[model samples]
Target: MKTYNVAILGATGAVGQEMMNVLAERDFPLNKLRLLASKRSVGKTYQYKDQVIACEEATPDSFEGMDIVLGAVENDIAEQLLPHAVKAGAVVIDNSSAYRLDDNVPLVVPEVNPQDIQKNNGIIANPNCSTIIALVAINKLHEYATVNSIIASTYQAVSGAGVPGLNELNTQVTQVMNDEKVEPQVFPYQIAFNLIPQIGGFDEMGYSSEEMKMQNEGRKILHHPELNVTCTCVRVPVMRSHSESLTLFFDKEIDVEKAKELLANADGVKLVDDPNNKQYPMPLDTSDQDLVYVGRIRKDLTQNNNKSLTLWCCGDQVRKGAATNAVQIAIEYIKQNA
Candidate 1:
């Protein structure tokens, strides 16, 4: 096996830290690992197996002599620095929405489109975590029955917002328990015991930016140019992992039993669909893991045909959605080149 020098652009955030952990967990061949963050986090240290890695202030010069740079930062920071990494001859697998829709950058989910990794020109963009999970849960069904339309309602965890979001939820819950006034900051409103229907700014059509991603990124990744998606994104009080309810319309007929059979053996997906015993995919059980757990299989009564069905899925957005996805892309890149 060969090793590569890798750097994580946003080494201190939730997703960045998960990326580091996933690399170690999956035993990514490593010659060197560099952690990069803002000036405030410059001296912070993190645990990676037996080594204590210190974070450095990210600069254009930081990408020099690196085989790969895994981006786990916001779009603004990624837009500012990733180009420099590419110019310095390092392939970047970004977890941000910075270049997801770019014609040149491939928005990848290894379970859905591993071949897309080879078409990258020094950059590979990981799709939104929700998009990744939703697509992974249904990709096999799409293959067997040709998914034509998607109806999704996402119950996203506070961790989707990062560390501050998690802290806000914790603080609010504690304040509520103490009968104190709760201050809303990390989210638009109190997310302690209530749900926020909006995840991002709403468009003229009343769809949030996060909702539109289910369609836009899904179209790009699945290569289903005509795929239709109607999505509703809600911020729930859960701590980690995201759960989605999906109603799919396929071109070909597919029964509930068939859907379960396909998903049970699908790659990157775990089947937990025994409803008789009250077992189904849930965020509480799916957190801190890579595979998307899918269950609650049933025929969509509203569709009026065998061509439509519904299912539920859950995945750790921080891991499978961001960090782990980028690391998997990097691993594929390494294997493809080798």
Candidate 2:
């Protein structure tokens, strides 16, 4: 078996750490695993399998002799560092939105568009966490019947914002329980016992940056440029998974039973649609795993035709959405080009 040298940028952060876990869990073929982060985090130790690897400060020279570099940093840092990794002869699978829409880079969701991986020009961008969970749940349906449009409402977890978001939610909930004043820092307002309708800065048309990602990234991943999406993203107090209510309009007739049949055999999806018994997808059941749980499948009540269907889905944003997706891209890359 051939093994490759891999490096993880932003190794101390939530997604970065999860990338390591996924790499270990999947038992990726590796000759060496390097953990790279800021100077402040240098010497931080992480366990991969039975080996304890210490974090090293990421520099231009960090990608020396590396075959793959998984990026889990913010856009600015990704913009600054990832290109250098590419220059050093490493193919980068980036989780940041920095290069997602770039014409030269491929935005990939492995199950939805693994073919696009071969088209990458040294970089592949992972779709937004919410975009990933939604698309994974719907890709099979789209393939069976061409999806013309999507109306989605996302209930995002605070963990989507990273470790700070998680910490802020924890602190605020505690403060509220103790009858203390809540101070909002990571979020615009208190996220404990509240829902914030805004996930990113609003556009002139009133759609937020996060809401627009569903349309833009979805189009790129599904290769359906004409696909329309109207999305509303909300930040909820859930600790891990993100849940979404999706109403899909297809080009051809697709009944509820057919949608359920397609999703039952779909990759990366678990069907839990026994609504009569009060079974449906929820954040608590879907958290801490890679599969996207989909349920509540039914016909759209407002739409008269069979072309419209409504369903709900939940997935762990931190795992399948960010870390596992990037790792999957790397795995696919190795399988194709190894």
Candidate 3:
């Protein structure tokens, strides 16, 4: 087996660290591994298997001879550094919203659109984590019947906000438990024992930036520009895994039994729809894994037609939503070009 040189941008952060873990866990073929981060993280060291790899300050020159670079940074840093990495002869699978909707960049969900990898112009953007999880859960249904619109509400985990989100939640819970005043930092308000209906800043249309991604990114990834999505994203107190309640409107009728059969065989999805036994998809059950657990499959009671159905799905936001998806894109990219 031949190995390629791989570098992880933003190695000190949560998703960045998970990228390293995914690469290691999957036993990806790599001749070398490089960790890059901000100047303050330059001297930090991260363990990769039995090796201790030190972090390097990311610069245009840092990606000297790498084959692939997995991005796990913010939009600003990605804009500044990724173009140079591409110019330096490396294909980048970026996790930021930076280039997702760029007509030039390809937004990919491996299970849904692996062929789109071929259209990349040196960069393949991973779809929003919630978008990725939602698409994967219902992709087979889309294939069975033409999906026209989606109405979704996401119960996203604190892990979606990275390390700071976790820290803020933990600190607030501790403070509030002791009857002390809680301070909001990473989140706009107290996230412990409460839910925040907003994830990103509100748009003029009253939708948060995160809420809009479901429509915009989903349309791009599915290659269905006509697909319409109305979404509300909430920040829940869970430490990992995001759960979504989705009502899909299809052009054709799809019963609950058939939907279960389709999803049971779907890649990256696990069917756990036994409501009688109390077996349903939950954050605790879906956390630390790649598969999106989908359950509570049933027809929409209010629709009065077979064209619509409702389901719930859960997936580790950090893994499948971020690191794993990018790595899978890199894998598919390698196979097509190799």
Candidate 4:
């Protein structure tokens, strides 16, 4: 079997740890595994298979001789480590906002932009959690019916902000349940029993950076420069899984049955639309699954020519939204390079 030496930066963080699990779960070809974190995390050990490996302080030296470096670190750390990996001849699959919009780095979703892998300058970017989930559900439709516009709203999980956010949510929920008023920290406002319509810092236009990523990243991944999208990102009380309600305007009349059949066969999508039995995709159902569960399909009442279709999609932000996608990019790279 072919083998590759792999490095996972920020392995102690949520996405980093999930990257390790995804690698093992997918049985990625690894001859050596290196886990790197900050100085504060040094000397810590994480279990991989039956062996325990120490976490090293991440530096340029960490990439020496490694074939692939899975950059599961923060944006700042990924910025520092990515170039170092490139200098050391390692292919980097970076899960960060750092290099995503960089003209040189290919922002990729393996299912949509696998060919973009060939354009990598030793670094490939994983799309944002919101963008990844949105495109996965909408791309196939764009192909068949020519999606002209999209209006989407995302119900993001606290976990998107990492472990601290999850802790804050849980703690705040407990306090509120006990009839205590909780203060917000990780989020700008209280998130225990409330929804925060803003995610990431708001730009001058009032759209959060998270909301704009769908249009920016979608164009790159779908190779559709003219595609228009408007999104609202909200932090929901859910601990994991992200849900999106999308209204798509297609170019032609869409047969409802045809759309269902198309989505049922799409890669990484599972259709669960059976409202008669009160069946549809839910965060609770998609928490652990790799596939993007989609349902609640119906033609839009306000648009003609079946130009609109409303649907819901759910995916684990930590899994397909982060780690699994990175691993899939690496696998695609390895396959093409082979």
Candidate 5:
């Protein structure tokens, strides 16, 4: 078996750490695993299988001799650093939105568009966490019915905002329980037992930056230039998985049972639909895992024809949305080049 040298940029962060775990969990063919982060995170130790690797400061030449570089940093840092990885001859699979829409970079969801991986010009962009989860749940259906448009409302977890978001939610819950005043820091308002309707800065059209990602990123990944999406991204108090309500309009009528059957056999998706049994996808059940749980499949009540359907989905944004998806792309890239 051939092994590759892999480096993880932003290794000390949640998603970066999860990338290490996923590599080990998936037992990727690794000759060496390097953890790279900012200077402040240098020397931080992380467990990967039987080895404890210490973090190193990421420099311009850090990616030299690396076969794969998984990026889990913010957009600014990604913009500044990832190109160097590419320049150093590493196939960079980035989780940030920095290069997603770039003409040369392939935005990929392995199950939805694995073919796109081979088209990358040294960089492959992982779609937004919400976009990844939604697409994984619906891609099979889309292949069958040819989805035309989507109306989606996302209930994103605090973890989507990273460790700080998780800490803020925890601190606020404690304060509220003790009858103390709630102070907001990571979020615009208290996220404890509450929902924030906004996930990112508002656009001129009132859509948030996060909301627009669904429409824009979705179009690119699905390769459906005409696909329309109206999305509302909300920050919920849930600790891990992000859940979404998706109403899909397809070019042709799709039967609910057939949809369920397809999803039951779909890659990266788990069918949890059984309405009478009160069984469906939930964040609690989907957390800490990679599969996107999809359920509550039904015909759209507002649609006169059977061309529309509604469903619910949940997935661990930190994993499938960010870390695991990047690793999956790397896996596909390896296969394509092997």
Candidate 6:
């Protein structure tokens, strides 16, 4: 058995807390564990099996002798800590979007591209929540039939924005129920019982940052630069789990049954397609689930050339998308380095 020292950056945030839960649940080997957060959360105690560890302010020296640093902070914080971790001879598995597109950094999903981790320049990136769930279900299909294009629309949860986003949604819902006017804070538009078509800031091309991530990150993970993706990411009024409606266009003709068969046996994906009585993947069913739930597989009616297939997928974004993937990277690093 190999043991390694681990540190969780942004230890008081939502993704950081989720990383702690995943580390405990997966029983990861830990010779030493450290929690680093902002000044506001410093000195806060987080317990695991009676071992109460105090959260410290994350600085350049936070990575001292650390074997692996699980980054659960924003892109700026990740950008700052990544080099520090590398300087300390610790590999950084970041959950932020900072390094996802860096030519030197490897954007990895253990199920889709475990080999990508081997290309890491001391930094591995966990992809966007919607992209991770979508790719986990479709990468197997892509393996058999190459993907030429993807049209995805995401129904993401409030939790994707973190705990404060959830609180803002819940507060607005309460205000509306009480016949009072609701005010939006964390989101650009109202998010209670409403859908905000924007997940991240808009780019010059009119696509939101969250929407473009699917295309940019997909190419890196699949090693397919010409893979075109058109996505519209929406923030829904849900607590957890992100759902996506995907219509994938393959280079070769693909049969729906064959695609289902391929996805049924794919890693990190759970096929739940049973449309006889309206059974398929849903945010409610997929919440807290580790596996990416995929269903609603069908041939695209508009594109009758047998090149396109539509599907629905759901998964716990914080787990499979952020924390679980980061922890898996840590495990892979241990396996290779130990």
Error of 5 at 202 (Å): 1.1
Worst 10 residues of 1 by lDDT: 297-306
Clashes per candidate (backbone, < 3 Å) = 0, 0, 0, 0, 0, 0
TM-score of each: 0.99, 0.99, 0.99, 0.97, 0.99, 0.97
**Candidate 4 C-alpha lDDT tens digits along 213-329:** 998888888877888899999999998799999988888888678789999999989988998999899998888668888889888988666678988999999988998899999
The candidate 3 region of ten consecutive residues with least summed lDDT is 42-51
Task: Give the alpha carbon lDDT tens digit for every residue of 140-177 in model 1.
Answer: 99999999899999999999999999899999999999
TM-score of 5: 0.99
Give candidate 4 regions above 4 Å deviation: none
Model 6 segments beyond 4 Å from truth?
none
So what's the TM-score on candidate 6?
0.97
> Tens digits of per-residue lDDT for model 6 on 100-179?
89899999888888877888788888898888888998999999999989999999999898989879988999998998
- Candidate 3 on 1-338: residue-level lDDT in tens? 77899999999988999898899899898899999999999879988998899999999999999999999999999999999999999999999999999998999999999999899889999999999999999999999998899999999999999999988889999998999999898998999999999898999989999999999998988889999999999999999899999999999989999999999999999999999999999999988889999999999998977999999999999999999999999889999998
**Candidate 4 residue 209 C-alpha distance from true site, Å:** 0.5
Could you tell me the TM-score of candidate 2?
Answer: 0.99
Q: Candidate 2: which stretches are off by over 4 Å? A: none
Error of 2 at 113 (Å): 0.4
| Global Cα RMSD, each model | 0.7, 0.7, 0.8, 1.1, 0.8, 1.1
Q: How far is candidate 4 from the true structure (C-alpha RMSD, Å)?
A: 1.1
Report lDDT (Cα) of residue 89, candidate 2.
93
* Greater-lDDT candidate between 4 and 5: 5
Question: Tens-digit lDDT track for model 2 on 1-338?
Answer: 99999999999998999999899899999999999999999998989999999999999889999999999999999999999999999999999999999988999988999999999989999999999999999999999999889999999999988999999999999999999999899999999999999998999999999999999999999989998999999999999899999999999999988999999999999999998899999999988889999999989999787899999999999999999999999999999896
The TM-score, computed over Cα atoms with residue i paired to residue i, of candidate 1 is: 0.99
